[model samples]
Target: MRQYRHFDNVLLVVFFSHPRYDVNLDYYERTYAEYFPNMVFVGPASREDAGFNHSYDVIVDSYGSAENLTNPEFYQMAGRMAHHMLFTVMKDHPCYHGYLWAPFDTLLNVPRLQQFDQNRFWYHSPFGEYVPNSALESDQDPDLHAPPARISPDPALNLTEDWKGWGPDWCDPHVGLPACLPAFRKAPSSQHRRLASFFENGTERFLGGSSDTLYVPGIHREAFLETLALFLETECFMEIALPTTVHLVVPPSERILFVDHWWIWQPPFNATFVRMKWEEGFEVDTFHTFHWGDAAEGESWRAHPENIEDVRELLQESARRQGVRLPVATSQVTGRSPTASSLLPVDQRQA
Candidate 1:
């Protein structure tokens, strides 16, 4: 992915972790820090406070949100913190134009994403294939990236998980909490009202896209993140909370660029797929997520972790996707690097 273009100058590829789960943050930082110095690790303070031989540029608080949302752990409440999280990074390094919210296990199609306009908001969806004959079209064509007037995906299937949410009008914030109490005072700004108007006459629906590989431009991200946090205040599913906010909070919806790819739905393959192709060995068309699984046998297809910069080890949620030791990603013995490149991540080099 780095070969086609150097994302170090264009975007910040983030690998984030929640405190509840376990992943070897130090191993990853040490392993890829030399070549992919552009990347950064984000873990909860608890993980750092627990005293691991690690340091993170961006650290987020683990809200115990899965329990709070009464939803699955996969949601990660990433949508809730997107706003404040970026602020933490952008405050010091103003050079970055965008952020890609990806988990440690994710493998993005850097070249595929780079072909499009980085200035626009980016997301890929299975809800509806907006790009016709997407495989044949040149993703770089200026005409191909325009946003539709309104994208109404299959009505029977809503993008937002209506089944697993509390409300924009919930009676209590503690609905799923240990104590019963009122929460998130229905403080609807006119924009919130517009958001409410979206649901009042009809149910609020989601634009619907994978939580992974989401790209919010710096210009629009703050608003997008703020709205996403608002939705989290209601305990909306992160998947739904994300795209819904993308549709509502991001103005000039025309700027919302959805990249439709086969890799997104089940992606190029399931999380269990193996055989991490060599960095130069991969095809340019696919982002090719690393083959992930946790048995001692599962590690073999991991793009030859010993030789490549692949850090596809399964973390808590990803580890559970197949089978695992429970909380942490399957452990591997990766020696840390002694040299920190001049390319070291902004937060690392500057801070």
Candidate 2:
């Protein structure tokens, strides 16, 4: 077991990469060194480190097989591997205060990086309506139900009536990919119908109204997954295991905040939100990290260098406010190249 030296509330940014996106890592390192000096980057050891001493708080051992949509089991294994990596970090570095795990393409916008708060998990609510233990197994559980409020399913669509029910806090009017909505309405699978009903009903009922949008910020991680798993087992709803619900996690407390309007599958929407963040100056104040999901897409941070620069400036400013200097490095460090092993065949890797 590797012993990691203790640090005050470290920000752990996670990523898995291929050869083509190595440049993304290079730029990320440079930006981190220049702008956010207080933070440390942890990643895998490379072949080039033959005799060289590289400093990293943690290193992921196996790269695991790549994911493919066509093959369900392979894809599921890949996701499991990703989750394992996160769990490894949590287990090994319990002393560290908070973690911000994201794909490599994620960018930092503000200079003052908000340290993670362990007590509260931050992420964006997938369902626009906030429902309490709706995520939990039963409404009777005191741990899940808190209060009641009127929630509208669609914030985009104006509904005059608000329905009262038990639900989580933090409902926003952001439904993912419009195309997905039709599928839910047509086939009406439990997952699909739940999504459609959320849109149609406009309000989620539960105790303790929406937690607050700022609470849930980013990708679904270990804590949130565990919570969901517990909820599904209790409710006997196996569909929650589907990949679509990956982002649906509990609402975060005000102390722990999540920057919003970013998703893994959607690109144009994320770009638009980023632009909005830049315009409003909100990005400078609150956000520390920006995830550009799916390196293969056109909306990737790699494709939008200008946006990356905007984020870089934010990180620099944040560093200055925090009174910390990022480690400066001149030599270029490239991430591992994509290989046959790295690229698990679509048939073998899809889950």
Give the candidate number with the greatest lDDT: 1
Question: What is residue 88's positional error in candidate 1, in angstroms?
Answer: 5.5
Model 1 spans with C-alpha error above 4 angstroms:
1-6, 11-13, 17-37, 46-51, 55-60, 65-95, 125-204, 260-351
Q: What are the per-residue Cα lDDT tens digits for candidate 1 across 278-333?
A: 22222222232433322245231223334223333322222233232322223332
| TM-scores of the models, in the order given | 0.53, 0.41
> Best-fitting candidate, measured by TM-score?
1
How many pairs of residues collide in each model? 5, 48
What lDDT is reached at residue 239 by model 1?
41
For residue 192, model 2's alpha carbon misses the true position, in angstroms, by 24
- Please estimate how well model 2 matches the true structure, expressed as its whole-model Cα lDDT: 0.34
